[model samples]
Target: MKHIRNFCIIAHIDHGKSTLADRLLEYTNTITQREAQEQLLDNMDLERERGITIKSHAIQMNYKYNGEDYVLNLIDTPGHVDFSYEVSRSIAACEGALLIVDASQGIQAQTISNLYLALEHDLTIIPILNKMDLPGAMPEEVKDQIIDLIGCERDEIIPASGKTGMGVYDILAAIIERVAAPVGDPQAPLQALIFDSVFNPFRGIIAYFKVVNGEIRKNDKVKFVATAKEYFADEVGILKLQPSPRDVVKTGDVGYIISGIKEAREVKVGDTITHTARPCSEAIQGFEEVKPMVFAGIYPVDTEDFEELREAMHKLQLNDASIVFEPESSAALGFGFRCGFLGMLHMEIIQERLEREFDMTVITTVPNVSYKAYTTKGDEIIVNNPSELPDPSKLDFVEEPYIKANIITKSEYVGPVMSLCIQKRGVIVNQHYLTSDRVELVFEMPMGEIVFDFYDKLKTISKGYASFDYHQIGYKQSDLVKMDIMLNGEQVDALSSLIHRSNAYEFGKKICEKLRELIPRQQFDIAIQASIGAKIIARENVRALRKDVTAKCYGGDISRKRKLLEKQKKGKKRMRQVGNVEIPQSAFMAVLKLD
Candidate 1:
């Protein structure tokens, strides 16, 4: 056990976490040079295209240090705030973490967020300065920032460039020297923590876990503490780029168990596995069920494909336990599922995977956060959809979820960024200068206000120089009201949204204008309006598609032409009164993009 090192890499997005993992794989000979590629640990194509890690991956490496063979288990984690839960779970599975900071961009919001998480896990942190090869690299300055933030000495921080493989070997050596090995008793009853799992058609559900006590061997019957289901281990192995069969997984080691369970949902992440015959006294602590923070309605573009969509979601959920969904229906969009996600990026990844992997076309409603609605009788209920909110007459007050937002950016962009946050109903909490040029600003804001397009706008306002991160603080009492959209004097429930009363007018006006541009002109005039209950705050008119009704009578008398024109005008008036305006799918989607 002393020769084993269990650690993970944690950093902000684009801070060379994946690249460093690739270098480590190559150094340890886990993968041949001919087969190695960029971002080796990132298995999803969407991750490669977006240049971000969405899922946490674990791999085993065999290294030789000072003529002694050392086994290193490295887990690569997502750096985005949306996957902070994933990062936390990965941290719990390891004894130490490599805190990577960009040499050019010193510390970021996610860096601070991840550092706090690592500290909470009580993991030994080895700060590493990455991207030192860049022309703007300021290793010395970043070193000072790390020392100030974590109170570590200067020499303890490692400086290296992941792109050039500089200091890669030294970083590996540091891992062996600084990271403590896993401590467990091989004689104790079996107990393991399932950090991640995936479904396979041939092999069933493969659970990736770290052995906390005793040992696991082939054909051992293990029971999941949460589900209380037992299954014989059909296979036992470690990830050497791919799963390779092993005789047994000893204590303080990481490996996988292929239980004959066919369903992915059977083996839940954060669940404990114990030997069925020689079971442990109790399950492990620090296990948290994944809770989704964002909710949206996903509907098949073709109503007939509803079953296919459900099947796809079921298969996807087997691999991703963080997703939660149930049957939902809308008058405008018909039958669908109300799905919950950790954040917007997680929601987007699931949607893309469904479309690309399952070949299903889906339309998603605007993402929303859960709200607390208080009734007149003192009953409190959770509302995930705006249309589901109870009538104002029966409600005492509404409370919305708030978050503590942290923003790190160049000092020059502070004014614009602060103005943008203020516009989003954010209250400044604290501010500090990280260095001569970088500033850190903290604010308290409603999660609903920023779930849509706050990140995109922040990047734009800061000229792509700002890094933002946030966590849910709690619910706060707010003067919020639901606004509904009306088309031809009929309410559209899917277009309803909850917004603060102060910004109702502007939000309604912007949405009305956007809908007008998206909705195609009909044969009769169409009136699109935004209303709160019966009171209309903003309206837009889409003029009717007029034709030359008198063209055929051009060669005839002027009186005839005037008569035809009058007839056409009367026809339009009748159509306006009786015709039902048909809205396209694009209009519904366009409204979702309105910031």
Candidate 2:
């Protein structure tokens, strides 16, 4: 048998994890010069459009190094924080990980977060300082930071330009030497965690797995270790790691099988596809289900396409397990789906995908952070829809989620950035000066505040010198209230919130204005009121339709207006069916958009 190196490439968003994978494929002659492309591992159109890795994609490559054929199982992972759970599962399938860092940018907050997760998994760590060909390439600086943070030996930091293919072979040699061989057996009951899988129109369900203790072959009756369900695999093959797809994987390696199982939901990443002769017991101990931290209501722009919108949601959710949905009926957007995600980036990625992949125009509510509230009855509150908040008097206690954030930046902006965090209800937990001009600050802040524009605000305040990482910490008791939006004297259940007393006005103003913008011009004047317990704080008017859209039908014009109104009524039917208007997700933007 030839040598095997099983590993996953990990880095922060845009740190060039996929770029390096492309270079590795080219260096191994796995792909022809013409076939090798930019960011080869990013297979999804949405991933290509957004310039971020959303799903973990795995492929195999046949490479010859030191006169030995090596099977390189390359797993490319999602870099954004929202998909960290998926990334962690991807990392578990591997025996080693390539810690790709930006040479000029040095180590970032996400770099640290992902690296620590890799270490905790006990995966052999190989640090590859990528982008050495950039304008301000500082290999040594990045190397030092890797050592300080990751604590890998100095030589393990392979400085390479994944873009220019510089030091490609050196990194390959390091891969062969540094990454440990898989200790999984090909003889025990077939036990492997399904890292990721996708559907093929021609081949049916392609189930990918990392065989831990047994063997699988064509025609073998296989059962999921978790489900203990058996199926027949018509075809078995390994995916040649390339820009395109090929088949044929093997024992003690990463690959996929064309099983007769047609249901895509049956084969999930954390599910184990095993040999029926001797099925393994559990999948993996920490196969976490990722709940989306951000949420938006998705509806079609042209009301007539409501069914198309739900169909699009189903399609998007097929590949993205993180997206959660429920039947949401709003005043503006009728019969649409309320979708949730890990964070803002994750939400944008889904929205962009819905439009690009499905070829549909969408009216999306802005993304919002999930909140938990408490009522005066001492009952624990699970508040996802802002429409659920009770009257202020009915609520005695409420709190927003908090996060432990780590910010790494140049020392010059440390003081300013620190002040900004404090202003956002952040308490400084710790601080460390990494270098003479660089510092790392850890803060415990309300996730509510950090979930907003603070990311952009930090970049602006620090002049692009700062990087940040945050994950959920426990929730804390916060002095907050439920602000509600009443359209034409009727409370729009979906347009309420639990907000800090000090920050409530800003949210009230922003959301009230958003409703005004979304309510659309009407036939009669509409009152848009934002209030707290019947005390109106702000109001706006969406004037009635002065024309009643009654232009002469020069050429089906009257038919068009009637058709539009009929369609609008049909769309309005999705709304409460009582008011002159509906609260489509757009109106939910106040709840979704900022935080």
Candidate 3:
């Protein structure tokens, strides 16, 4: 156990964490030259194509130092803010974190936020200046930023390049020397912390955990403390590139267990696993529950697939525990689930994964943040969907969730970035310089304002130099209204959104215009109106496809043409009454891109 080191790599997006992990794997011989690849831990194809790590991956490696073999369990964590929940779970299972900072970029928003998370867990932090091979690398300047941020000594910060495998050996040595090994009694009752789990069609669920106390062996009758379910350990093993079965996984080790628990909900992440006969006294207190910042309704394209969709979500939840959902039905979209996501990116990734992994075709409604609505009857209700909001007459007020947004960018782009935040109804909280060239801007913004296009707009305005991170900061009372889109006098609940009263009109106007372009022209005119209760703010119409009955009578008398036109007009009116418009899948997505 003394030679065992468990640590995870933490950094902002594209800071070379996975690249560094690859080099570490090579030095430790975790994977051979034939199997080497970029982002080897990011198993999802979506992750590789997008050049981002969507989930935290754990793998065990063996390294020889001072002529002694050492066991190193490295968890490669996602750098995006949307996946911070994954980072927290990874942190809970490790004793140390490798804080990688891009030398040219210095310290960004996520770098600071993830550092705070690691510090809160009291994990040993090893600061590494990555991308040293780049021409713009500034080791000394970034070292100063690192020192000011973490208050570590100058020499303690290692300068390394993930591309060239520089300083890989030094990082390995630091982990053995600085990181504290797991310290728990092997003879005590088994207390293993399940940090992550996945579903396998053939073998059931595989739970990855760290043995904090005692040992778990193959064929042992184990019990999950949270669920209080007992099952025989069908397989017990350490996680390498693949699952390597073993007779036993002892204390201070990270490994996986397969217990033939077919149901995805049976094995919960953060639950403790112990022997059924000699269970631990208490369950491990893992990280706090995930707080989803965005809510959206996801319905199957075909209504009959609702059951299959639910099953897929359960299996997905086993892998990504951050997602929270409840059964919901929409008038327009039919039976579906209201899923809470960390952010837009998280929502997109989940939707894509459902399509690719589960082969579930789904229609996602407009994404909105959760709100607290206080009714005149003195009842406080949590409204995740605009359709759930109380009637305006009975509603006293609505409070929207707010976030403390931290944005780090080059000093020159501060003006544009500040203006962008202000346009999003954001209040300036503070602004400070991290270095001579880098500035950090803090703002208090309503979560609803940024749900649509704030991230994209910020990236565009800053030319992709700014890094943004935010956390929920409770709720604040705001003058808000529920804007509903009505197609021919019928409200589509899926397109309804709660918006600030000040921006509601313009936003509604934009949506109306966008739907006008996206909705195809029907035989009868389609009336697309954006309304707040009885008051319609904006309206657009998709013109009917004219048959031109007059075109057939080229030389007919004026009275004869008028008679034909009148008959056609009455026929159109009758069709409008019975013809229900079909909204294209793109129209639902179009609401999200009305910039």
Best by the lDDT measure: 3
Candidate 2 per-residue lDDT over residues 1-595, each given as its tens digit: 2388888988877789888888888887777887777777777877787777888888777778878888888888977766776688788888889988888777765676688788888998888888888889887777887888767689777778877888889888887888888886665667777766665557666666677666667787888756556788777766665323334345577767777766555666677776676666655553666655555667676777887777666555556667788866556456677776666667667777777777887776544455677778888776655666555677877777889999989888988999999989899999999888879999999876765567767866976557777788887888877677777787765556556788877777777777777867754567888787767888887765544434544575466777766765565344434556666544554455544
RMSD of each: 4.4, 7.2, 4.1
Q: Better model by lDDT, 2 or 3?
A: 3
lDDT of prediction 2: 0.73
Backbone atom clashes (below 3 Å) for every candidate = 0, 26, 0
Q: Write the per-residue lDDT of candidate 3 for residues 1-595, one digit (tens) a residue.
A: 8989999999988999999999999989899999999889989899999999998999999999999999999999999888989999999999999999999999876787788899998999999999999999888889998998899999999989999999999999999999999899999999999999999899889999999999999999999998899999989999999899999999999999998888888978999999999989998898797877667889999999999999999999999999999998877778999998877789889999999999999999998877999999899999977888988899999999999999989898999999999989999999999889889899999998887778867867876678777898899999999999999999988899998889999999999999999998999999999999999999999999988898877775898899998998999999999999988878987788787
Cα deviation at 200, candidate 3, in Å, is 0.6
Best by TM-score: 3
Q: After superposing candidate 2, which stretches have Cα over 4 Å from the reference? A: 152-156, 201-204, 241-249, 281-286, 289-291, 295-318, 324-339, 358-384, 390-480, 486-493, 514-527, 541-595
lDDT of each: 0.87, 0.73, 0.92
Indicate the worst ten consecutive residues by lDDT in candidate 1: 286-295
lDDT of 1 by residue, 205-240 (tens): 788999999999999988999899998898998877
